[model samples]
Target: MQDLKGKVILISGASSGIGRATAELLASKGAKIIVNFRSNEESATEVVYHIKEMGGEAIAIKADVTIKEEVNAMVEHAINSLGKIDVLVNNAAGGIRQSTFIDASEDLWEETYKLNITSVLLCSQAVLKHMIPKGKGKIINISSTAARIGGAGESIHYAATKGALNTMTIGMSRELIEHGIIVNGVAPGVVETPFHEKFAPNDDRLTRMSASIPIKRIAKPIEIAECIAFLASESSNYILGEIINVSGGR
Candidate 1:
């Protein structure tokens, strides 16, 4: 759809959820994908296999995105294998359990910061080193609507980190656009993904949240993936530094 043929893309946390959807969707459009997973190689390999089975190209790599060395190594490996990365989807984030402001733990804040903020920083910097020299690249950061409403008191720490990502996205676009790299963000409201399964399953959060969303239902990962796909394409060349909200008018 975007003339993604031969475009090499790298997606972090692609073993599942939105990252996996983006990888598969991009691959389906003729883009070669590097699926980065921290530990779930089995799932990552499954994604690669699915893409190949569908006549697309894909590979899986392991990296803890929060660690600079690991992120750098993963990018190096991807560059070595693919020759070049035309796009980067900073989708690695999660492991957040909801808590209130007064009840939030120190570990919660620190871990959330690492997952949402530090990882984006590490991955972007690592990829920018290559993209800046090439004079062209697309970076789509996966943020959340929680950044605006502060998670409605569910996960303030996570929301705070995403707010930072929103800021970083704008700053990055301004600084990097001159180098031919477009940095933007996608903020999803409520999605039906493994993220909810891990963090909101106990209370059937989706059911309750659906009543509040204007769409009256939760979104699928592919819905959000579609937006990422748009930003990854040259079609969005004129659009820069903006965070597109993909929520159901929440």
Candidate 2:
């Protein structure tokens, strides 16, 4: 395990799913964790409670990451509470209420962009104000396999935003590396998370989707969390401008 004994890490949308998994995993490695949630205080507190029980330090902060003002406030709270952030995991992401491409409305597209793309922008900029000055930091963006495959016909808008994020990751990595801030991305495939339950097709379709992958099954949330942990570690110091594919041969 990477020794993150004193590192402070902030993860957005950490009340549940991949975000929650990342928080617990990073904390387990000795990093002080800031778990950011939009509206789920109870869940967020549970995450913090679990971390504390395991002898890790953590605090919960709430913010609607898509909003600039709230993003700034959340960052402020994190800095005040944790002293400094050594890593940022941009993990809060979502799409429109389930819809086929033809049925996806412009409003849905707008909301999805705000959640998936704009939030990354807002959170990154707010946190960079601190990390840039420190002259060294890590940023891990939670993209999706959908970004490369274009959704399963129902999440084109979400896919589009992730694609934009992929581009942004590369551009930002090149731009930020000079400042000693390493920016990278993780694109996860069919993970076993609530996100699939809410956004993907029915269970029968999901079973088939899983069967079709080369691994013949979906990934556990921790599998992706493990990858994020790596990017946040000193082990990845030589890597830059890379968006790793955690897909199960998708």
Q: Which candidate should be chosen as best, given TM-score against the real structure?
A: 2
Best by lDDT: 2
Task: Give lDDT tens digits, candidate 1, residues 1-250.
Answer: 4778989999999999998899999999889999999889999999999999999999999999999999999999999999988899999997478888889999999999999989999999999899999899999999999899977637888889999999999999999989999999999988878887766775566688888899899899999999998998878999999999998998
Model 1, position 136: C-alpha lDDT score:
93
TM-score of 1: 0.97
Model 1 bad stretches (over 4 Å) = 202-204
Candidate 1, residue 6: how far the Cα is off, in Å: 1.2
203: Cα error in model 2, Å:
2.2
Error in Å for residue 33 of model 2: 0.6
| TM-scores for every candidate against the unseen true structure | 0.97, 0.97
Clashing pairs in 2: none
Model 1 — which ten-residue stretch has the worst lDDT?
A: 197-206
